[model samples]
Target: MPSSVEPARPAGHHTPGPPGPAPATPPSGDGSRVIPFGRRTTRTGRGRRTPQPPQPERVVAPDSPQQRLALDVEAWFLAHQATLTDEAAAHVYRTTLDFLQLMLTSSHAEERLSPDEYQHLTGMMQVLRDAPDTL
Candidate 1:
């Protein structure tokens, strides 16, 4: 007895065409297809790209001997102030007051002191009275 089986269709027949490579696609107006390697593309709306504003340059002053000396004196005074005990600080305070009063009296006698200087001297005297004497 002969078998009654139909012949199987070939794979190429089902797909059609000689499979001779895919057809080339035309480029889209949006430029989405071609990308440069290692570079990214940004989508900017129809406006023109504006250049960024320049940054302001910083100005620095050169250090001078007088300024350095002033800083050194300030630092030394701060260190000395830090090391003082309450009793010693009180004594220093009294001494400073006496010295300032002497200077103010001399300035008054010489008529060389400005009103502002006299007022500042008085303010310093008041501050010394209120300040804690020792560290």
Candidate 2:
């Protein structure tokens, strides 16, 4: 309402609110909570966090290079997903992507994975990235 950039809303209709992030714009890249510019963190009349707590740092062991890489790539992809061309997007499956996203973003995504095991997941992502017809 106080914003000079956003046009005034209709008298009766509610002002447009952020339902979620826009395409290519993720809420946060480091797993920290981030509200978009000019968007309310909560809905009007809805229960919102009072005195938000400090987000724990997303730190992983220095030894797990593969795990670290996985997180970095997942975060990057999430932040850039909206920019992917339709042809590139078509090659990926939502379900598979979601699964990889979750697995990579998990606190200890590489807990049980060996170097070889990590390669398997990355290989799967690569295969899925541009899955071409075998026929």
Candidate 3:
């Protein structure tokens, strides 16, 4: 006959039972239904729908007076390339060439100068033409 005490099972053996239903979630404090984890909640207030600030206008006006003067100085250096002194002229020539090349490369087509820009360039040319040998 079998003994009253049950024998111990081997290391990995076990009996299976019926699966239980999933646990119910707790109610929210405000009395609204609670969502599951990893979900975003909808915003409640109208303040959440605030509009963005307007962007600034972009104007592409021509270059300013100082820029025109710089160009004029550059042109004077170019026209007097032969007269530039050995000490100063080489450096000035290289720098002016670089500036002129950059201006030309950036523009899609050659831009016509304003009357003021032209006057500024011509005035600079006159000064270089009349300046003493010391310059």
Q: Considering lDDT, which of the candidate structures 1 and 2 is the better prediction for this target?
A: 1
- The CA lDDT at 2 in model 3 is 26
TM-score of each: 0.34, 0.24, 0.20
Could you tell me the TM-score of candidate 1? Answer: 0.34
- State model 3's lDDT: 0.49
lDDT of 3 by residue, 41-85 (tens): 586676776787987644323464444544565567668664344
Best by lDDT: 1
> Clashing pairs in model 2?
none
User: For model 1, how does the per-residue alpha-carbon lDDT over 1-135 read when each residue is reduced to its tens digit?
Assistant: 113275745534442333466447754675334333664558555687778898864332345443444344445557876422355755675687788888887896788888888778777665444433211
What is the lDDT for 133 in model 2? 19
Summed over model 1, clashes come to 1
Residue 82 miss distance in model 2 (angstroms): 22
Best-fitting candidate, scored by TM-score: 1
Question: CA lDDT of 78 in candidate 1?
Answer: 70
